[model samples]
Every structure is written in C-alpha cells, then in structure tokens.
Target chain A: MSETPIAAPDPPPGLSELFLAFASMSLAGFGGVLPWARRAVVEQRKWLTAEQFNEAFSFSQLLPGPNIVNFSVIFGSRLRGPAGAAVALAGLLGPPLVIVTIFAMLYTRYGDIPWLQGVLSGLAAAAAGLIIATTAKMAKPLFEKALATRSLDAAPLVALAVFFAIGILRWPLPYVLAVAAPVSIALAWFRR
Target chain B: MKGDGDILLTLAGHFALLSLFAIGGANAAVPEMHRVAVELRHWMTDRQFADLFAIAQVSPGPNVIIVTLIGYQAAGLAGALVATLAMCGPTCVFAFYMGRTWERFREARWRNAIQSGLVPISIGLIAASALILALAADRNWVAGAVTFATAAFGYWTRLNPLWMFTAAGLIGLAGYI
Candidate 1:
C-alpha cells in the first residue's frame, strides 16, 4: 500500500464556502447524506482523500451524535476551528430543518389518507432494509480482516457479543458499551 | 399533559443525554427514545413514533432530525429547535476539540487498538439498530416481506437505495404490501 503524503497541501476553505457546501449537500440529499458528503468532500472539493475520508468517518463514528454531524464538526474544525464547526453545522442542518418541519406539518394534516399511510409503511420497511444492508457491508471487511490476520479474531467476536447483548437481549446501550468498549480495546491491545 | 415549559425542559434534557449515548448515530438510541417518548411520557403513540421515524428517514439530511420531529410533537417549534440543538451541541463541541488534538496521536498504539476495537462495536451497534427498526416497521407479513426483499436487494445489488425506497412506497400506495 502506498502511503498517503502527510498533509496533501490543499487550500483551506473559507467559512462561507463551508456553509454553502454543506447546505447544498443537505438540500440534495434525498435518501441519505453520506454519499453526497463523500462526493463533495473527497471527489469534488478535494478536501480529503478517499482514505482520509474513511479514516475521518470511522473516527466520527466513534464520537457521539450523528456520524455526519460529527463529521462536519471535525472537518470544519480541522480547517478553521470552532467557528468553522458552527458554520458548517448550521449549513448542514438549517435547510433540512425547515424542509422537514414543513413536511411534518403536511403529514400531520393529511397523513391519515390511506394511500399515504400505505406509502409510509412501504418506505419504513425499505428504510429498515437499508440499515441492515449497511450493517452487513460494514461488517464484511472487519470479518475478513479478522480471519486474514489471525485464526481467532476477538474483534468480530466482540462485535457479535455486542449485537446479541443489545439486539436480542435488549440490554441498555450505555452499560453495554461501557463494558464492551474497554474489553474489546484490551483484547486488541493484547493481540497487537 | 404537562405545561410547555416543563415539556420543553424535559425534551431538552432527555435529548441531550440521549445524544451522548448515540455511539452509532441517533438510530442507536431508538429503543431508549421509544421508552421515553411512548411509555414514560406518553408524548406520542407507538404508531406515531414509527411514522415520525419514517418521515425523518424519507426526508433529507441526518437521522438525528427525528429528535426535531419528536420535540415538535411534544412542544411546538421552540421544542423542535431546542431538541435539535441539544442533540447536536454537546457532541459537536467534543468532536471539534478532538479533531484538533487527534493528529497528535496518529501513531499511538493505544489509539490504534481503540480504533480496531471500536470498529466491530460500531458495526454491532448498526446491526442492533437495524433489528430495532425492522421490528418496529414490519407490522405484518407483507411489510415484513418488503423489508426482507429490500435487504436482499440492497446487499446483493449495486442499485441506489433510493430506488428501493421509492419502489416500496409505490407498492404500498398500490395497496400491495
């Protein structure tokens, strides 16, 4: 694997530009925003390389709140500190907030229409499927890496334990993470 | 029902705490959100909660916007704004500071170990989220079929997910699913 040069030396984005970029991303994102975010940040803006984007996104996933929201904060702050984060977040969320609110109001008024209910039910099911697909795609690589490196992989096992504890057993998430995270980290340390 | 101030305060406080536990994004907190909104507070019915989640999913931007809808249902526009900010604020601050210092530990062994460990945990969280949402959405066999088909298609195909969403909606509209 070729090493990415440290700091590819891209020009820093202005606060307003950051705002516009995120605002446009939010506006265009219909089903989800992550794909659009990748297109803009990695392909269009050239702000982060594909590998860097993956690393940043993985790190963002470890943080609390929405992955994309955390991503905007980390990306913007990397460029221009706290103020940049604020602006980028505002841009990302502001337009969608207004649009979604309007949609909510419309649904409140007319949601009882039978066809709309049918449509919603279908969409909801599809949404659940999308989540499942995402989980499968993410897990595949981890499982592969685990088997590739060692005959026994603690990472995939810990993950399955977490899935069972939370998904089937219905344990409280905070407590599960509190135990699982530290244990898994230690396991990785030992394996390393 | 509670007064607006009480409701807003409750909404803000609850969502703020929820935001911190959202390790795999807002969806990870769905069961907890369901507990607080449906069972504890009676803010909305189970069906209503489900509908709001669907709306949030269909609309643009992040999944966290469901909190805005929940807050709006509970306490109007102010509640929506408060819930949105409360959900995003604390974590944003944390990410901002972490981003500044993260580069310093790029090669740290502990950091690598933590990252390796956390990947599976996060994947597990996402799987848990899918299970929760599937149980919530699949109210009947037909809906269950839609969900199963969609999952299969999404996993095996390279098609954009929006098409699945659209096709499912149309199927529902046609009263087939």
Candidate 2:
C-alpha cells in the first residue's frame, strides 16, 4: 500500500473559502446534505480524494452527533485547526438556521393549508428517494472492493444484520450496536 | 406550566445528552427525540411534531436542524439558538480533537481496520434511514411512485437533484400526490 507521496497540485483552500463552501452547500442541501458535501469536497473543490472523502464521512458517522456536522468540523480542523473548525461549523449552521426559523414562523401561521401540506408531502417522499440514492452510492465502492478480491468478508453480512435489526425490528441503536460493532470490528481485525 | 427559563434549560439539557448518543447522525435519534419532546415533556402534540419533522426534512442544511424546529416550538428564537448549540457544540469539539488524532495515526494498522469495519455499518444505518423516510413520507401510491422514480434517477444519473425536488414539490402543489 505504500506509494511515494506527491504534492497536491493546488494549495489547500483558505478559511474563508472553507466557510463559504460549507455555507453554500448547506443552503443548497435540501433533503440531505451529505451528497452535496461529497460533491463539493471531492468533485468540485478537490479538497479530498474520493477515498479520503469516504473515510472522513465514515469517521464522522462513527462518532457521536450528526454525521455531516461532525464531518464539517473534522474537515475544517484538518486543514486549519480549531478556528477553521469554528468557521466551518458556523457556516454549516448559520444560514440554514435563519432560513429554517423563517419557515417555522410561516408554518405556525399557515400550517393547516392543504396546498402547503401537499407540497411538503411530495417533497418528503422525494427526500426519501434522495437518501436511498445516497445509500446506493455509498455501498457501490464496498461492493466493488468485495468483488475484486472475491473474498468473503464480514462487511455484507454485518450490514445485513444491522439493516434487519434497526430497519425491520426497529431496535434501539445502542443495544444493536453493542453487539454489531464489536463483532464487526473483531471480524475485521482478524481478517486484517 | 413551567417557567420559560426552565423550559429552555430543560431543552438544553435534554438535547445535549442526546447529542452524545446520536451515532449515525440525527436520524438515529428520531425515535428518542419523539419520545422526549412529545411524550415526556409534552411540548407539542404528535401532529405538530410530525409537521416539524416534515419541515426539517424539506429545508436546507442538515436534517439534525430538527432540533432547532423543536426548540422553536417549545420556546422561540432563543430556544432555537439554545437547542442547536446544545446539540452541536459538544460533538463539534469532540470531532475536532478526534480528527486530529485520527490524522496523526493515519498509517496505523488498527485504525484502518476500524475505518473499514465501520463503513458497512454506516451504510446499513443510512439505508435504514432511507427506508424509514420512505415509509413515513410515501403515504399514497403517487407519492410512492415519486420516491421510486427519484431514487432510480438519482442513482443512474449525475444531474443536480434540486430539479427533481422542484418538480416533486410542483406535483404536490398541483394536487397530484
């Protein structure tokens, strides 16, 4: 796995750029923001390679709290330390907070209208689709790796167990993780 | 009724605790949040909570901002501020420190295993999130069709999804769903 390191072609983005980029993505992110985050960081800005983006995002998910919020903080910290983390977090949060509040105010006033309800219902369904798409995109790389190796790995099996426990049985997260996390990690450790 | 300050303090405390437990992100904590806000504290009715959930999902930014909406419902603007900070603050700091450590040990063997091991679990949880959202949002067959079509389009194409969202909303506005 060792390869000679090469310098990045472009310099890392500055703090302000980080802020603006996060802010723009946050606003543009309807339904879910992770896909937008991946798009901006990996495809558009080239801040991180696709693999790096997946690792960072996976780390964020492993940690407590919201995955994207943690992702923003971690990414900012990686590039520019604490202040960068602060700015990215602020950027990710500030604009949407204001806009959502405005929507909240409006909701209280016209919440009962059929048209508004209808629009929201449609949007919600589409939002679900967006997440499904995101899940598929995330899974593709793992499946590809499994196929290339043609080795039986714990990944797909563990993933199925998790989906069944949480999605179908609706188990509380902590209990399911108590079993799945350890078993998965052990399987990975031995295999590695 | 509890005093305003008491309510704010309570919201802050509860969300702060929830923040640490929200593994796999905010959607993972939806059931807990529902129990706390609607059943325990009685801040809002079930209908209001469901409406706010819809609003949060439809808005921009992280879906976790549902905390902001819940806070606004219970208190006001200040409530929104308090709840959001409470939910994000500790986790942000934790991520800050953890990110540094993770980078420092990027080449470590165990770290790589941990990283690879966690990916599938994260994917599974996200799939669950998608399934739950589909169940909740797709009340009618038209809406379900929209969900299916949107997923297929999003998966196969690289187009900006905002267009689909706009079209879906318009369909709703037109009384189709």
TM-score of the A chain in candidate 2: the value is: 0.70
Alpha-carbon interface RMSD for all candidates, in angstroms: 2.1, 2.9
lDDT by residue for model 1 over B1-177, one digit each (tens)? 548889899998888887888877777677667767876899987767777888898888877888889888878788889999988988888888877677667788988888777778888887887887788788889889989998899899988777898899998899865
lDDT of 1 by residue, A39-103 (tens): 98889988888889888887787787888999888887777768878888999999999988887
Residue B10 alpha-carbon offset, candidate 1, angstroms: 2.1
Report the error of model 2 at residue A129, Å: 2.1
Q: Compared with the true structure, what per-residue lDDT tens digits does model 2 show for residues B1-177?
A: 559899999999988887887756787666567667876899887656656876787789998999999999989888898999999998888888887666556677877777667768777877877776677777789999999988998999986677887888898889987
User: How close is every model to the real structure, measured as TM-score?
Assistant: 0.90, 0.80
Q: State in Å the error of residue A161, model 1.
A: 2.7
Measured against the native two-chain assembly using Cα atoms, what DockQ does each of the candidate structures obtain, in the order listed? 0.68, 0.58
